[model samples]
Target: MINQLLLRFKLLKDDKTLIIVMTLMALGLTLVFSSSMSGNYRPEVMLVDSDNTSESREFINELKLSRLLRYTETDEANAIKNIETGMSIGGLVIDQGFSDMMRNGKEINLSILRSKDSIELIQLRSDVQTTAFKFMSKFKTADMTVDIIKGEGFKVVEDELFEETYALSTYYWRYRNPFNLNSQVMDAQKDWAYNPMIHYLIGFTLFFSTFTIVFVGSDILKEKQQKTWQRKLVSPVSNTVIISSLLIVTFIVGMLQVGIIVLIGNYFLDINWGMNIGLMLIVFAAFVYAFTAIGLVVAGLAKTIEQLGAIVPIILVSSAMLGGTMWPLEIIQSKILLTLANLMPHKWAMQIISQTSAYGLNVSNFITSVLVLIAMGTVYLLIGLKLSKRHVY
Candidate 1:
């Protein structure tokens, strides 16, 4: 095993593999960062407030606090014009006497003008309606109390009593709404703090690491094609040692490549690699083992380097695509595809990295992903070892 490891190291010492790995790391980082930090498409919403009172201003402020919508204060005429021109998706027209009606507990109406209806716009509309309702809850409660008192034949001045109760309630309702959303405009600063690039970087790293298996598998196939494997079989070196050596070398190569990329990503790219570096390393090792075992399986199947070169790319690309390397798995709406994706080691690896890198959570957050990866690797290794013992045709 030690002799094989030394031989593997000497073979990999050439600039070819290093140059390829570095080039890929550089290109992948550039594309991932650029694409992830690309401008967000915020849906424009023009606000037309006929009642420009303090209450109306408060409502507008609430809307501005949401990052979901790019809101602008404009007149009804301009808002209508923008909507017609398709410059804005929608407009919120705060009708005349909106504040007075809301204070007096009258049914309030808001004119929502949209250029075209879509699912996203519908969801935004729903969010706006819900927020408006929550904002008016205090007034609605006060109005109901006043109505109840009047119905009891009390000679209470409705306006004065309502104002007093509204004031008292305002003081009592000091706590923030539990459902209050913390939305920030997508600026460069915030983008740096919560960058999507980190996820993409981790994802692409795992995706590219699968290719190492191809190289390892090709090496095995090359030995068989050159009849070196048969020569080794006739030697005193045992079959178990040869198999163990191949597995160990492949595992080491995968780990070293992955580790190099990760270091480059963290230090050179200035990415926050979460707080749990130890757990992250463990996940990386599990993933490497999984893919390396898969490479052994490919080696067992392929007869030559040409065969490996053809077969490995297909598997790697397909697995990466399904495992959220090519795109986010979240956007894939197919239940069947999603279920199938879970079978890929890349998916579990990505999940573990995503949890640790983004959330800084403990092992509890990603133990399932780690376990899935390790178990998959163990199964693949067992099957691959069994296959590795067979003579290549």
Candidate 2:
């Protein structure tokens, strides 16, 4: 077994096709990591001051202090126009009676106009609510001080209105932070989801895996057409030995492919792959084996290298679409499509790898995913072997 594995490893080392695959994988990972990790946040806010009261002006002043928010004060009409034209992501409207309502203990109305960007909208809304609460808290505290000195409930109604405003705004803050709060609390790490290195690594890994199958399978077909496969079949090696040798070679080549890409991501792109290196290696091995089995099945069944080459792109594109390579699966709200995503092995593998990298290995999930991958590989290998038996013709 050791001798066979070593021989296969040497075969892969000399294979130009494997070298090209690894090079392409590395290049793809680099490009993806660079693009995805860059921050996408631009806090452009348009403030519409219909009230133009002292309290509203003070509120806008407080908001302007936030480094994340870029404020442009415009009248209600202009603010609406700017938002409609996509000149700003957020538009804050302070109603004409906003200040009077607070002073008179009446409900104050405010409006937020936002573009179609849900993330930016949610973030800006939360920031506005927070600023409003801070301002109201200061105002209430001052009012309480005056009441204590005067020994009367002066502006008690105003304080009541402030409380009402705070209460109403609390609902908007509920979904403000969609990223994992626990992870943030534990590590004080921001940009949890937008980490370019990690996202790119995962996306590229999946993309490369799906694409490489075609090339690898085509190489096998080419070798067969060149009569290299006939030479292997006549050797004293058993069919199991030959197949195992091929799989071992492919697995090692795959690992090297992933390792080089990961190294580039870590050093050049600054992607944190988390602390569990051993677990990552295990997951990578499993994904490679499973995908290689898929390639083997393709190679075994393909009548010609050209046929294998032509079919691989379709399979890869389909897998990428289903596995959330083009976009995160969380964005897909369709229950039926989401349910179908669960059935995709690429999706499962990508999810398992991503979760493992971010949150460390979830023992149960990791084990289950590994088992599934192995099962898939076993099924494909069985089918390939059955087909290979017919190669005697």
TM-score top scorer? 2
lDDT of 1 by residue, 30-77 (tens): 565556445685678889999998778767876776666778999989
Which pairs of residues collide in model 1?
none
Q: After superposing candidate 2 on the true structure, give the runs of residues whose Cα lies further than 4 Å from its correct spot.
A: 1-7, 10-194, 356-361, 390-393
Model 2 misses residue 155 by how many Å? 7.0
For 25-70, candidate 2 gives per-residue lDDT tens digits of: 6467657555543456456788888888878887788788765568
Evaluated at residue 158, the lDDT of candidate 2 is 55
- Find the 10 residues in a row with the least total lDDT in model 1: 185-194
